[model samples]
Target: MYKARAWLSRSFTALSSNPLRVCVVGSGPAGFYTAEKTLKAHQEAQVDIIDRLPTPFGLVRSGVAPDHPETKIVINQFSRVVQHERCSFFGNVTLGSSVSLSELRQLYHVVVLAYGAESDRALGIPGEDLIGVHSAREFVWWYNGHPDGKNLSPDLKSTDTAVILGQGNVALDVARILLRPTEELATTDIASYAWTALEGSSIRKVYLVGRRGPVQAACTAKELREILGIKNLYVHIREDDLIKSPTDEEEMKNSRIQRRVYELLSKAAASASSQPMLGQRELHFVFFRKPDSFLESNERSGHVSGVHFEKTALKGGGPGKQYAVGTGEFEDLDCGMVLKSIGYKSVPVNGLPFDNHKGIVPNIRGRVLKNISGDSSQVENGLYVCGWLKRGPTGIIATNLYCAEETVASISEDLEQGVLASSSGLPKPGREGLLQLLDNRNVRPVPFSAWEKIDSEEKRLGSLRNKPKEKLTTYEDLLKVAT
Candidate 1:
């Protein structure tokens, strides 16, 4: 008991004498939230956030729909978090290239991997690699001016009809962008190149295809409502498809949000025939259809002309618990473009234990586990994860707050337990060591102050154009602005 007490005293003394050094390997919502929680709980801890891009706010800046500018208000909060005295931002510094995970483990006492999903799930179907097929992830990033997406020029000129395979908010977002008037998006921070391409878009019809029924839709009620409210866009729905089964009815009764969504969908379907307008684009909800393959166009070789689908039906479970089973029946929809919006997936970082099935780093609570089962005894000390990388790619932006808090709590508990004690005789050098290494590598990291300059420049350009901030889509331009 005396030795135990003495060890505890020494641990606290060590932590108190020198502040804990924490390195967060992402500048997204999860990273910022973790930093905020860590800074608030451990006043002596210094946190450093690093990102692959010069600008921060991962998805908020690159993944969100351009027209939904209000959703990005969280950036203001993230900015303040980065500006904290105990926190530092290091942008344009990639984890694998600029420094290895092993190097980070050596430099900081604790390393938090908050880097969100970097890849999209693929639709394992024939002709998916065709010219006209694109992942909704790439499309969203292209419109939002992500440096990696700047070169992706989707062929909007060839298609009057587009089929998006998924019913999530992301699918709705893609549909809304395709159907929304260009004038509405002009005022937003959409990439100028995207705006130019969209102005010439021939798309007039969009089919939001999903494998599951309406009750199992992944989109939120707010997004559904917004999609329904778009002017000059006629929402087409099959009345039979909206009819709920006895099981679905019971599920809807239990969920207020589901009940409301059903009611709204019913109302829209009922009014579809009565309210008719000319020269209007059509948004069709095609449910219970699983993409079987993409059909090639005879006129344009290697380009997708349409999609083949196997009809699906709900089995056993109810509402969100339901799963889609393919029926013998088959159907085809002729469309020039296909955007697969199934979901996002996290890519495996070098030297990390990633579960390919779950698309996440194998972890118990917040501590990264050694294997896929996440055995408690195999916990990787001083290593943690939060957000989509910890959990799968699920939930909204606000969801990261709770997830990050939980991770921070786990980290705090570990600290108190002395699980983060240095194994080597030498103490970790933390940010100072990292900066010196970065300097040695000739890697010019964009600091928060430099980012502020870029922000100011964007706003200045926006003011001149009478629109939201104009983004630097290319790395060269962004680097120049930052400098």
Candidate 2:
């Protein structure tokens, strides 16, 4: 035990003498988890997490539904990480605009791109650019008070029926938010602007359209059940859509979650009454409907009035592998609002090799590769990726924890092998140098302390309204609060 303690003491001394400087782009779960793991493993490692927003906790603050405050509890854990002695946070610093990848590479010994997928996948059909057609990403952000999403004035006032394309958890979230009582959301951290707008919403029915069958839905059973539990919200499912294929029995035998989801869906459909409750809302699950194009409104030339869908049939495949084949038959459903919740895709950052098709940085495990071929021999030394930027957008928040561990392990291995030894002589300026560069550019970064002030102010304001917290939606307001 004495010898072991002595070795640890020696290790600490060595680490103190030569610390590893890491700059993680994107102050999200992946970035914080990576920093936490890296700092714990390397005693003398210093980390700076950067984000484009004035506030931290990227998706946790903006992507998660305000109604689900329990999920945002992860922010408390992230708060602890940013407050670590070896860690710092630099918010309101745009990656490509304020500081380029080349600049970050020159400033830190190791640069990890944990920036999440910010762009949503397009439906690539006609009339997608019409008014009243929104992406689930921007809609969620707008409701959650993301700076970029503040201007997204979705026309909820013009529509009594809304249609959301895609059957993922995000679609379910949109459905729930539309159908949930405005009074219930009053105590949550939902953006005041969104709350005010939603309070005046005329929406009464929401259609969740999926190209595939019920067994092949991307949403988890928990989210589906939550949508089903909303008071005065009646769920509708076509009986024919629930009919199983020949392979469904075999597939259901292999996965318990799938079985449970099927069971819940079936039970909900069986219990649904033909007539909705008085002043109640309706949620319709329309399966095997592939969106072909959006229909234009007669009253408003540029606004969407309905969606044209091509009927689809299930083809032979395994449980999760089922494919949708389009039939010639077409159907139209009238609605003023259409939100596409297909999925999210990462955008290409300057100086980073992005796989255009895959919508992710080209990398082998965590090491950023120079080409799309993924040849490890052609790796860009000292550059790495994690989270949705490394892998395509998928998985839950906990998924990033393991993803960060793997990336940090790779970084540690490279450091031990002296792959980054050449960085010792480089003009790696660390935080001071980076801050100086930002100063020169007149970029005011919101430090962790300032963010704490904003957080406190938000909570204080929320208390006045009996809500969890009120977010500052505008950039100017956030900066004002932080300053």
Whole-model alpha-carbon lDDT for candidate 1: 0.88
Q: What is the TM-score of each candidate against the true structure?
A: 0.95, 0.96
Q: Model 1, 110: alpha-carbon shift in Å? A: 0.5
Taken over the whole model, the C-alpha lDDT of each candidate is 0.88, 0.88
- Model 2: clashing residue pairs? none
RMSD of 1: 3.9
Write candidate 1's Cα lDDT for 90-151 as tens digits: 99999999999999999998999999998988877899999989999999999999999988
Identify the runs in model 2 with alpha carbons over 4 angstroms from their true place.
Answer: 1-15, 422-427
